[model samples]
Target: MKKLFLSTITIFILIACSSAPTKKDEIKTVKVNAAIGEIEGLIEEDVYLFKGIPFAQPPVGELRWKAPRKLAPVSETIKAFSHKSKCTQPKENEFILDRGVTEGGEDCLYLNIFVPKGNVDISKNNYPIMFWIHGGSNIWGTGNSYDFSKLAESQKVVVITINYRLGPMGWFSSSHLRNTSEGDDRSSNFGHLDIIAALEWVQENGNSFGGDPTNVTIFGESAGGHNVLVLLATKKARGLFHKAISQSGYVSSFSEQFASEESELSSAKVFQDDIRFLTEDQQIADYLRDMPIKEVFQRYKQADESHLYSISPISIRDDIVIPKEGIYKALEDVDPSVVVVAGTNKDELNLWYLRSKYFYQTALNLGRNLKRSEENLKSWIKYRSNIWRFTGAEEPLRRMSKSNQNLYSFRFDWDEEASTILGDYPLFLGAAHGLEIPFISGDYSLVPAYARPLVFPNESKEGREYLSNLMMQYWANIAKYGDPNTFVQDHRWNKFRIQNQNYLRLDSPEYIQMVNDPVDADEMLKTLESDSTLELKERCLIGWIAEMNFVEEMRGDPPFDFCSEYTSIDLLKLRRLTEGRD
Candidate 1:
């Protein structure tokens, strides 16, 4: 019976693949003479898509760990029909919602372009350009994961998505390597340099695709959001983009000394330990450059297994890619005309908290006791997510508003999932991290298949569509006019000022409005201490995780040391032992 089932599934998959529309038969081909070369794209449902167009040479072999090199002009026609391989990174766990390809290659420096077929005339050369940066903690993500066709066609703008190097290959920092390199290649932030190179390519080729290079807007979520903030802080990206939006981005950067050789846990020190068995001399730079891609990934895995490096450091302050003063101080000195939008979800951490065995449990007979866990779960998410909002969105926008008056802030609170036998997704996931991606892209299919029905049930389709449309309008308006409120007249999205501290509350039509809600460390600490639902150790654990998410300087000294009695690792161990996972 099992063999029969497997055979039936295989046959079904074959039938499905055979019946699907082929590109040559169904898609209408279109050609454009970009600066790099003549390229062939496809038009499907009034949206022209150019996929897997190389903007930079592949960073492989001798080019590994170096800044991306620009592509030379080509007279030949380039076929851009399908996406290329994503950048090299670790395998993703099966259960995560944001999962992508299991394996990626080093030869992944490509980009995709989407243009509206009728709304924007290609001959006119005046549409706004929106550059998307995918976010997977800067370790795992590809430009191919997102589909911006609907967004492009509906908003009448040009959308570009590019793949960059990931993991250790993208942001490694070593003094040995730096001494041998020159110019921008000496910078430790290679991933950021890849973004800048893509932007330069857009400036050179955007006119051919009807996009206005001067009106470019760079936006991203999570690590991409973090990169957006990094670009704003660095002078290297000054004239590349005119507007920036960082959704759920935090201002955390490692000093050059810390990233290189300040401590045993530094990336450089950990890498040196990995290669010590292979070599012992001063020619480490040459040895690393010649190392095979598989071996480099193997060494990274071995180092991670030993816990020599607790977390990967991105956007290093090398005084080349990033300024020495750091992201916040540098934000105040950015161009005053540069518009900025920064925001966070109402319950950002619930995505992780809902899956944890430490806080939730299940039984065979009765379902998980939602009533018993409601208070504790809500309290933990409230305090920690508040800190995330304050550090990620409020603080950065407040500082930037000092110089740039064209600033906007928002809090996404659209949690209207239908209750199902599987679970209460509205309570568990809420407006969690990365949920806003679908709304912005107008790609509701991006929602995980397993939770799609419950999250976007037919009964709630009207509300979900309304909210998604509003978000897409706001995003496109910002790219076109440097203000989200230009076309969204009914909801006058206020500018973020230090005094008013007002932010748009993005929710269903009935709930969406501009509101004032400011968060501070002192208030968060006070609320944590006053809450009686949690024990002393529980409060400490929650406080520690929240504070540790941001940089050291932004984390003001709390009134009480929550981790004084028991460290966060200790609590994790205890939870595992109690849950019988030990």
Candidate 2:
């Protein structure tokens, strides 16, 4: 059955591929001179589709994470054929596509485009563009993991997606350590800078491919969503994207790795843990700085496995790349002109639950105490709720979606009956989190056909078509008019509750219901905050954690002070009072 499904989907895709317009019929693939390089792409259907376009110089050899340099111009007609290399992966424990699917390197800074077929007679294809940033917790995922064929075929819009550096390669920080000696400020957000470089490339060169460089919409799910939000907050990204959409990933609380004190502690811990592997103590910083990236990368590649939330990146210290307090202040001062669309899955932390079950039970049964797991589970809950809150509040003056920023929120409860991936925990983790992925990407075999997200399941062509149409339409519509309502395809997509709200709830299909009244932001957030605080039951066995040397806080970094202040009776600061192996 699986073979049949794969065969069918393969055939379906090949059929689409065969019919795609060739260079003869496709004007977009013209052998034109570009600012960066001379390349040849195909005019597919009515729009030009460019594949394997390099936005920056390959970060190979020593340039890895130094910063993305411009790809030198190729005066010859370069066939921009297959996907560029994928950004370095964050050591995966599971496989998504295939065992062979595991491939990446430093030279992975390439991007792809799928423009809707349109006017061949027109001199320039000025269609509105949507730039997709793939989400993988800034780790293991790719643009190829998704297909934009449906969007291209239906919306007639231009879509572009890119692969960026991941894990330590993408976000390792060196600032705020009180060391300005070697001075590399851009190291932390080099990945983001890569995206900006891509945008600059698009703005200067997208006209040939039928994209309206001035009208770009940036949207992403999970880590991609957070990246989009961050882009919206950046002065560098201003005017590059007119609107933004963030799904499933938002700033609820500071990700532990992004916290100034915490990020430093994490970086220090990785170095300290690996000290024995080093040849000399004094040369450690110089050696790491001067060593070839491929070597240093190998050493830190599997290092994240030793930590709790491995997908998160340690903060780049304060001085060079981005200042320590810049991001928080940026969110607190987001511009009002940027249109915003944000929401979460019916099960936001689905994968976290997966890790919890696998790692938690395995450790507990082995009598190996798991202290961090207890706190992480709670942090996950707060993180989920914060995605909604951050979109609504933070600043009354700078807030854009005061009910009109075209904000749409939905709870994705497609497969409520799906069993928990864990050993014992069931019922509580239902339709829980990330169950929507297969459906979201239109890949259902990964889950039971019965257990798929509603919008993109195979069972419902009508549902898939409706979702594809609605999602693409709303997205395209927002891109076109700062609003997301298709006269023929969608309902009057209403704005979410922006005045201290719980966000609009999508109870079922065929409904874009109005939020009857505002939800007290304070209450929902309180529940979230109260629930996110660490509890004693999870930490009851880890009695020696506080006294352990590894548990010390950074010099200025406050401990989980909010956890100390939590009002939830269920929460217990176990590390605070318990002093022994209780």
Among these predictions, the greatest lDDT belongs to 1
Task: Give one clash count per candidate, in the order shown.
Answer: 0, 16
Local distance difference test, per candidate? 0.75, 0.51
Across residues 485-525, which tens digit of lDDT does each residue of candidate 2 receive?
65645356566544533433432355434343332434543
Distance from true location, Cα of 236 in model 2, Å: 1.6
Local lDDT at 449 for model 1: 53
Q: What would you estimate as the lDDT of candidate 1? A: 0.75
| Model 2 per-residue lDDT at 503 | 38
What residue pairs clash in candidate 1, if any at all?
A: none
TM-score of 1: 0.90
Error of 1 at 249 (Å): 1.1
